[model samples]
Target: MKYTSYFFIFILLVAGCSDSELEPDQSIYGYEYFPLATGTYQVFEVTQTDYLNTGEVVTSDFQIRHEIAESFVSDEQETFIINRFTRANENDDWEYLNTWQSRRTEFNAIVSEENLSLLKLVFPIEAGVSWNGNSFNSLEEDTYVLDSLSFPFRLNDQGFENTITVIQADNQDFIVSLDTRFEIYAKDIGLVYKEIVNLNYCADENCLGQEIVETGIEYRQALLEYGAL
Candidate 1:
């Protein structure tokens, strides 16, 4: 009798533990962070040319550090901004793109509807190759991307060339704070010229006057471009 009673109690405990009367699981959404990368093509551009320090482009490796989106407000007013920088130099070490701690920007779905076919610079924007033997991109051509920050993206021509307007869907809105160029690999495309792009959105007469903002890009070429091998 005692043995039977003990066995019955064990089964009851196991069944109770598996019942919904136990504890519930909990989870939280993880946010991401991104910062603009230092100018490397600039190194390539000024190759053999005098720059901040070295007289020539000996090693392509450099350092890049800046603040990222520490957090975000899950609303339509998606905003992001960074104010510190130092791009391998002496004079412009800790300066903003032009000024320090300058004003940032905000964004909606439709960034700019203006004649954006201009102002915006194109990556592989050279239309030609660089001194190091970069090639001119072809239609539907593909190359190894070194960077891929799609922050300042304008979906015109599917990102083939610059000077194209960005079009978004009806229901969905944009979620970036900077109005700069979205980062990506210029594979078969061209040189990475524009780091930040300003989107000018002016729809109609009422909303037609003038409203512009900045957006930064974030891409991982090390992974996407297959780094080296």
Candidate 2:
């Protein structure tokens, strides 16, 4: 009787361990950070500032909408077609602007805009992980880093429960130029915010190291609304 009881206990223990091992990990791989579905759309408020060589500053404000129009199979991989529309204000009608493509693989998420393929994010999201953003394109190597992971962020009057930021480039020469670019994506939503600041600072003897802007462009896009159509 004693031997039988011991054998039963051992069998139970082994079975319990096996069951635990078979359970899947609940860890979030962050694939939902850039969820894609047909009819899904996001609207953004875009602000562009151009600093011309003649010291003229031009600023423009508009609204742009990105909709996942359809999906197609390419080379045995699925690709999404995103239609972009723009309007000057809330009262204006949206006009077709351009078309872009996006796709996700087991390892990375890629976006092709203006015929430039950029590796936007890598899977198994973790802060500080870096990859070459231009790996799929002919552009020079551009290192993109996961600057921040899973954090709460607020933009305009909206708030996001979880968001991640990708720092595409953050290089600056205090005496000559500055080029900083970053994009933020929210959980269950795509890109929430993007900013690009490429400016040339005055390098004259009087303004050297003073960080005075000479020329370049500053562009920003902030999410205004998002939902599935």
Candidate 3:
């Protein structure tokens, strides 16, 4: 009888341990991090800066709106949320730009933009989790490493309760020969901030002569407002 009782206690302990791990945190739901319901939308202030080989610098600032237009199912039965992108100057009307699509599965969330569908986030967000966020794009080899899954973040003077910050770069040092981008998302809100730095410079292998001329781009977008419908 003692042996049987010990066996039962062992089984109870094992069950309890696993149940704790399996239970969802209920605090960091995937949907809260990136809500995709129809009528959800966000507005951003965008700044574009460019450097020319002629030593000329050009900078422009504008506003953009991203709104969830609708939902559709693919041939494979996967559903996606369509976001309409529109842009305008400070005092001008918004001009339709393009549409982007994104969807979330049990394992990860994927967003299609700039003609490529790429993984954006993974479930059970925790620090140190890494993934190739730009695998679909062939322009440059890139990877996104999550620095803090629950980073404390503030936007528009409002503090977020939960935020995820991902650093997208070509190398581990947060630097690449081509470009690097940073994206931050908040709970129940989509991307709240983004910054992309692109560099285009040509030089010889030995780093001698003709390396004087270079061109590049710097872009930033910060969320100004958002709403969920």
- When sorted by lDDT, best at the front, the candidate numbers are 2, 3, 1
Model 3 gets an lDDT of 0.76
Best by TM-score: 2
- Write one digit per residue (lDDT tens) for candidate 2, span 15-40: 77866587765345788887888989
Alpha carbon lDDT of each predicted model:
0.27, 0.92, 0.76
Query: TM-score per candidate, in order?
Result: 0.20, 0.88, 0.75
lDDT of 3 by residue, 15-117 (tens): 7787668888755645678667777788899999998988898998888888786887776545555655555665787777788878877667888884898
Give the C-alpha miss distance for residue 24 in model 2, angstroms: 5.7
lDDT of 1 by residue, 21-119 (tens): 565431111011111222211221111211122222222322233333232344544332323333454334444332111111221111111211111
**Model 1 residue 84 CA deviation in Å:** 4.6
Off by over 4 Å in 1: 1-66, 69-75, 90-93, 98-229
